[model samples]
Target: MDSSIPSISPWRLSVAPMMDWTDRHCRYFHRLLTQHTLLYTEMVTTGALRHGSVERHLRFNAEEHPVALQLGGSDAADLAFAAKLGEQWGYNEINLNCGCPSDRVQRGAFGACLMNEPPLVADGVKAMVDVVSVPVTVKHRIGIDQIESYDFVRDFVGTVKDAGCSVFIVHARNAWLQGLSPKENREIPPLRYELAYQLKKDFPSLTIAINGGITRNDQIAEHLNEVDGVMIGREAYYNPWLLTTWDAQFFNSAESSITREAVEEAMVTYMERAFKEDGCPWYAIARHMLGLYHGQRGGRLWRQVWSNHKLKPMQPREVMAVARVALAKGAEVPA
Candidate 1:
């Protein structure tokens, strides 16, 4: 919400919506490192929202503003209802997940399978858009299984666009749902960034973001020259400091020169507040911070000290004390 940061253009940098990885605790910690970049929530199933504790699933920190919620489902009514719940919970945007190829997702008749039924996705988008003022976006793969033609993606985008979606986050790889494990699906699929670039060329009016295997800042800058946005996944989570420096390197904001000591102090405060006020378990939030100092001096020692001691049912403040001692030793930490 900084006045100087551009608001109207599509996001130039975004964190991908990875299940079990982009939860509220993870987003809260990432926010400390970057203020301008957009963050996404783990994908939530529409069934979970309709029949489960919707409030608990949607809870997020106030600092994690400009966050988007990704929903997984194919039914228009369920998706629309879920989008309404997301709006009421104060999300900046609602994203439909059409790229996941897991078997569990396929059984629900959603995810990447929806790519084969573009009209159904369009109907779902239209229904969600009608009820929420926030933007309804879509994240999808370039192609599913062996359908490698550019025309396959182009037609999918074309159909969905007619339903009033202005933003499309395209994972540059084709998902081989039949043979690949979800983990292998992310790696084994060959990336076709050219298809995403072509999408930008064809639909100049729509926001086209390219995602898949992007990690380095230089690569992100190069991708930005051709696409509307760049979304980073596993790399962002494993080495989060990459995002902490984004506001300065990409957005040209003043560098956050805050040191490891300062970040630790901030986390201590956050941990206390979350445990006392939000009723979050100490370990639930602590798990996300383990990678915070991933490759820094003494980081592994610091992580080991916490990992070895903190889970023994100690207080959150006690864990911070152990981490501070390990960090003081200044040893090299393996990432």
Candidate 2:
């Protein structure tokens, strides 16, 4: 471990920085599920901040506490400046996105491609650390393309660690930079949990969190023994109920998990308030929660009622009433 590395930050459970999905409203809804699980914003590129309005890219609710701002860029100066803006906007941590395999991100000269250039990443991390008081972190893939050696990721971590970044979120899969879409890269590459576990063994001083393909609570429990934390992506968004149980199960939290009905009602209230406050549409918030009823009997019909375009003219409370009536008629609950 490099002497310059900062102290490890506790990240027992977190959500991945999904591009279009994890926005401010999505995060506020997720916070209702489990208060303990850390949440991240979608990756904000340096160009968006350097040239555009910083507040538009960084605005977040205070309730989304322990939230992190993930930056996408290859330039050290731009990243550091963006990180400073994030801190000023009240983010808890600053994370660099080096694991994203998207073509747009690739063209920007950041994301997974940076894995092939460690020195540049080190300089960027150091610059961000120098400008902010918050902990600077990195989220990256296990390897890139045909590079299968474990040394590839190990060496990347070692180099970045020298720049005062001690916390790493490793998506345990190789990022196929070319000939693979971002969605394919997430699924095609086989997960090697051992590689992340070995990272902890080799760099005991740094905090390591394993991401990719981890969906269940049992899997989260299993990985906790090997690394400092676990990060969930699609599953947490698709089946958000999975997160309701996370706090009590993983954090030894006494906070009882809220019922699905309660969550729906809370969201309905939120939708009404958001409409009055910001004129936000009801469906925008409801769309993120379609999976709330997940495995129940009439969950599909319930979701359909909420998503119906004809109902868009109705208020969220009216939509909620219709959805409840549909669920009641269908007996959505399992016997």
Candidate 3:
């Protein structure tokens, strides 16, 4: 029997949900770079949202629209309740996190371990979809542990798709749940993009966005030819300037990429406002902007000035002024 292909959504480019990295502050920062690229929150467990301060976990800036909330849990009821909260919080989509391989997440019986139990994942997806008006998606690995069979992921996708998940972000690597640390899982496993492409071919109706080790604009361009979308992780954070070009490069946007100076200015304004309204420390915002200069001339000096802990007490505008001066001096950076 031919599987009915689902209608794909507008998910051409997305930033992967990095724990501790892609928080609300990071998402707001990313929104300044590319208006078209979708941003995701760090995985918020159902426990945190339900038992802890719900507002703190679910709150987000209005500017971070088209953003998705990635939820981590195995319980169908918890996931459904969390999805409902995400909808209430104005998230464009609700994403199930079946990709993380951290030991902490494993203890909860969710994350990559859920990949081994397709029925449970399916139930969670169905429950979330039934209650939430927004789309429910899943991010997962190509395989789990020592399992290398393509059929493992193929069946996983089939089962969850039946439960109403049409969009999938597939990290093109097997998650070694036991021996490797979370960081090692990202680096050690060889990326098998072909597996992702093949999955797209087999499940022609599903929206398959390839993740894992994709670092360049050309790579994103190339993947879009075969799959429905592309999701970038470390590269998007460590060197976020890459995202500035995505709006024009992939979305045919006529607006040129915003100047680095403009981005810095906007962030400074945000920092000032946040501090006044919420008492946010300047360095908390500055840490995310250290890579804004990236490869530009005097970029290192500018980064150093912004990240200098001594300036933590200084206002964000003063830090911005110092960074601008450093860039103006154009000090030679070591190769």
The C-alpha TM-scores of every prediction are: 0.94, 0.95, 0.95
lDDT tens digits, residue span 16-99, model 2: 999999998899899999898899999999999999988778999888998999999999999999999999999999999999
- Give the range where candidate 3 is weakest over 10 consecutive residues by summed lDDT: 1-10
- lDDT (Cα, tens digit) per residue for candidate 1, span 1-335: 79996664547899999998899988988888889889999999999999999977899988998899999999999999999999999999999999999999999999999999999999999999999999999999999999999999999999999998999999999988899989999999999999999999999999999899998999998998998899999998888888878888888789888776676677778878887886777677777778778877888878886677435577767878877778767663443
Model 1: lowest-lDDT 10 consecutive positions: 326-335
What is the overall TM-score of model 1 with all chains considered together? 0.94
Kindly report which residue pairs in candidate 2 clash with one another. Answer: none
- C-alpha RMSD for every candidate: 2.5, 3.7, 3.7
Per-residue lDDT for 1-335 in model 3, tens only?
A: 34595433468899999987898888889999988889999999999988999988989899998899999999999999999999998999999999999999999999999999999999999999999998899999999988999999999999999999999999999999999999999999989999999989998988999999999998998999899999999999999998888888888777655898898889988988888988888888778878898888899889889989888878888888998888878755454
- In terms of lDDT, the best-performing candidate is 2
**By TM-score, is 1 or 2 better?**
2
The regions of model 2 sitting more than 4 angstroms off are: 1-9, 255-257, 332-335
